[model samples]
Target: MIIEGNDPTVEPSFTLSNRLARQLWNWVWLFLFRPSPRPMHAWRAFLLRAFGASVGTDVHVYPAVRIWAPWHLEIGNNVGIADGVTLYNMNRLRIGDYAVISQGAHLCGGSHDYNAANFQLIAEPITVENHAWICAEAFISHGVTLPAGAVVAARSVVNKTLQASWTVYAGVPARPIGKRTQHEH
Candidate 1:
């Protein structure tokens, strides 16, 4: 859980360390990561690695992408995360090799338990398997797992684990719309 408190109504939601780290990261992002040129993928990767992220080779993470916590990220080889993407990784978030996270996509890794009196925070892992495509402006909710070769259509919303591989899902609360032809790349 991101926040653990007996009485959240009065207590702080995040720990002091967590808040401090995020403050430091925000400064780094403003001064270094966000201002860097688009082609400097390796440099950005290096910065993320320095902050405890496990990033693989040939990963293209754009300068405009917003990452909540680098320590919660694990990205594999050749994964392309485009500009305007928001990776709200309050929990562990993984992107497998060859996955493409299109521009404006939002992968949220945390939520609140509405049933709780204080609406307790709940952090859950999110996974995008190899060759998966999260299309432009899509919203992926907490604890979701997109299987290998799965495609989420533009502006789609996915809140649960996808069942099939190589399938195309679309619409709100995305459903399988078609099958994608799997190819070895």
Candidate 2:
């Protein structure tokens, strides 16, 4: 039953991902996503595995990784998440295949509930389209899309819509810096 405007777009969540409601950040990750500090590569996979992240093979996660909630994230194949990166995925945060998150990049999807009397809590889904590159210290605010093959320059603060496919965006709020060509290699 496919309706046009009334069609369904999302699924219902019935339970929280974590049952214990406790954090053994090091005690758990150390046993699973263990980092040798020497090999570097081994530690990368180990850390991801520890968080129950569905990480693809050969995906490199730096030691400085900061994941708010690993269960809410989905990273695709051949991904490279650099140092000083934050995956503040309070809800669903999807990173597509072969995406590069440069150092100091922030993937923040969590926020406070600004409506209720208490302004208790809020968080939204942030989908990073496939092949996007977020440069150093870039801040992607909640629910912003970085389209496929989009390149965000250093220190860009993206709080709005970002178009896909071979676009170069750079600014305080991140705008189209230049038009890229298919053969601009």
TM of each candidate vs. truth: 0.97, 0.78
How well is each residue in 77-135 modelled by candidate 2, as lDDT tens digits?
Answer: 77888878988876788888878899999988866555545444457789887778899
lDDT of candidates 1 onward, in order: 0.94, 0.72
lDDT per residue for candidate 1 within 59-154, as digits (tens), equals 999999999999999999999999999999999999999999999999999888899888888889999999999999999999999999999999
Candidate 1: stretches off by over 4 Å: 6-9
Candidate 2 stretches with Cα past 4 Å from truth are 1-22, 29-35, 181-185
Model 2 Cα shift for residue 68 (angstroms): 1.4
Best by TM-score: 1
User: Each candidate's root-mean-square deviation in Å?
Assistant: 1.1, 7.3
Q: Counting only residues 3 or more apart in sequence or on different chains, how many pairs clash (N, Cα, C under 3 Å) in candidate 2?
A: 3
C-alpha positional error of residue 167 in candidate 2 after TM-score superposition, expressed in Å: 0.8
Candidate 2 worst ten-residue window by lDDT: 1-10
